[model samples]
Target: MTTRRFFIKTTSLASAALFVKPGALHFKDAHIGLQLYTVRNAMGKDPAGTLAKVASIGYNSVEGATYTGTENFYGLDAKSFAALLKQNGLIMPSSHYRLGEDQENGKDLMGTILHDWDKAVDDAKTAGIKYMVCAWLSPAERGNADHYKLLAERLNKAGETCAKAGIQLCYHNHDFEFTQDNGQLPYDILLSHADKNLVKFELDLYWVNKAGHDPVALFNANPGRFPLWHVKDMDNTPQHAFTEVGNGVIDFKTIFKGADKAGLKYFFVEQDITPGDPFISITKSIDYIKKNLI
Candidate 1:
């Protein structure tokens, strides 16, 4: 009767033992991006309008979250999506796509489940996306260290596939990967076992902090492994709920100082749950990032 929440709590306790001192702050001008998932509702309603608003908010880059079974970018074909981004003055460098494990109940019958994978990669290339990320892991896909090992193998294969198409493959982590399984963290297994040349990571800052792990320590342990990041913040509440970037307690300034060490290439602002209008929330977050962190 062990629930995912219980497992997360236990893992938090386990990760608390490993903490490092905050490093010095270093600032650099980097292209600000947004994960389209934050405004998914709006995007679903009007992809063009949503992206236009996002661009008007000063986000020069974006990471897509609407590539599931459609193999299309927000209902638009690859070429059309690319054109739309150009019209909005935005560039898409990366996107989130569910892995094979989380799709079709982990089945691979005649490759129908992932039949659109090649086309997806091709479309991403056409759309100028440099990274194709495995966005999440199903509860069933994560059982133990062995399961993670198998998942890592799948990641490597996926990475190889993307590599052939001139794109990099990355895994996006949630709090679950930070938890331990038989004293071995799934994150460690994926980082240590996954092929470094083919597989990278897109670190979500808020989830890593919630898991009681230090992002700096992770960067120190595995240098140049993280090329992308989800720039979200956490409030001061006991739950550490999502908040606007500068409004939260997370020390993003110190974290960004280690961007070089983390091998950061692009970062996207993503507030999973906002209080009011998502556009206003993102605007405030981006303004804060420009003024303070980035």
Candidate 2:
């Protein structure tokens, strides 16, 4: 980690490739990846079958949305799950976890960064996951600026744990992160206060735009800090709802132009709510990407 950090900070940017993880795919050559939450219903029904369908749709990579609840991928243990993905010709580079601070409500979320982080990291290693993302916060988790500051410290600690295991720790943001709390933007507070070497970000494009922020400007302000992205688009309507990739107003062509500057390693297409069959919607997104974005 130290060596990679030094290389990124140095003038000889040409040496970057030497630091890439073995078997890792760069942004442009990367196969289209998906956030499994986009197909949560199907995943809950049949994880193995759902992964096969996702691979059939041209998604060779995926970001996991569960693990905190069961400490396993769907019903399979870490090693078993990895075999399942391999059989389907898929890779899971990242997964999401909650804060796990809500255990008082009968939520025995033991596979969380806060609860049994080492076990989580061990399982992530076994599953061949390279990144772990703090996915989301419930309403009760949101708090004032002080709360965010505290959260930053906790994230840095979690990031250190991940680093020790050769996994990068990232935080996924929503529109609420940009909302002013205690006279300060919570997102800005995190950016300024978090340990940059320890914690990076996975920018969710739709949520960032929904919060009235420009993704490019944010990338410019914090170059190389963002390596992962959620590529969901917003519709050109009064409601500005979620839509398929090329069927919306995101201007991915423009946004993708900043991929190199943003240190992009991988991006996943996600739509929280689809009109009908999610497989059809994902097929539309991948088709658009293949035809236009690449």
Best candidate according to lDDT? 2
Expressed as tens digits, the lDDT of each residue in 272-294 for candidate 2 is 99999999999999888755664
Q: At residue 190, what lDDT does model 1 achieve?
A: 96
Q: Lowest-lDDT window of 10 residues in candidate 2? A: 9-18
Instruction: Report the Cα lDDT for residue 152, model 2.
Output: 93
Q: What is the lDDT of residue 73 in candidate 1?
A: 86
Candidate maximizing TM-score: 2
Off by over 4 Å in 1: 1-29, 102-115
TM-score of each: 0.87, 0.89
Give candidate 2 misplaced runs (Cα > 4 Å).
Answer: 1-29
The lDDT of each candidate is: 0.82, 0.85
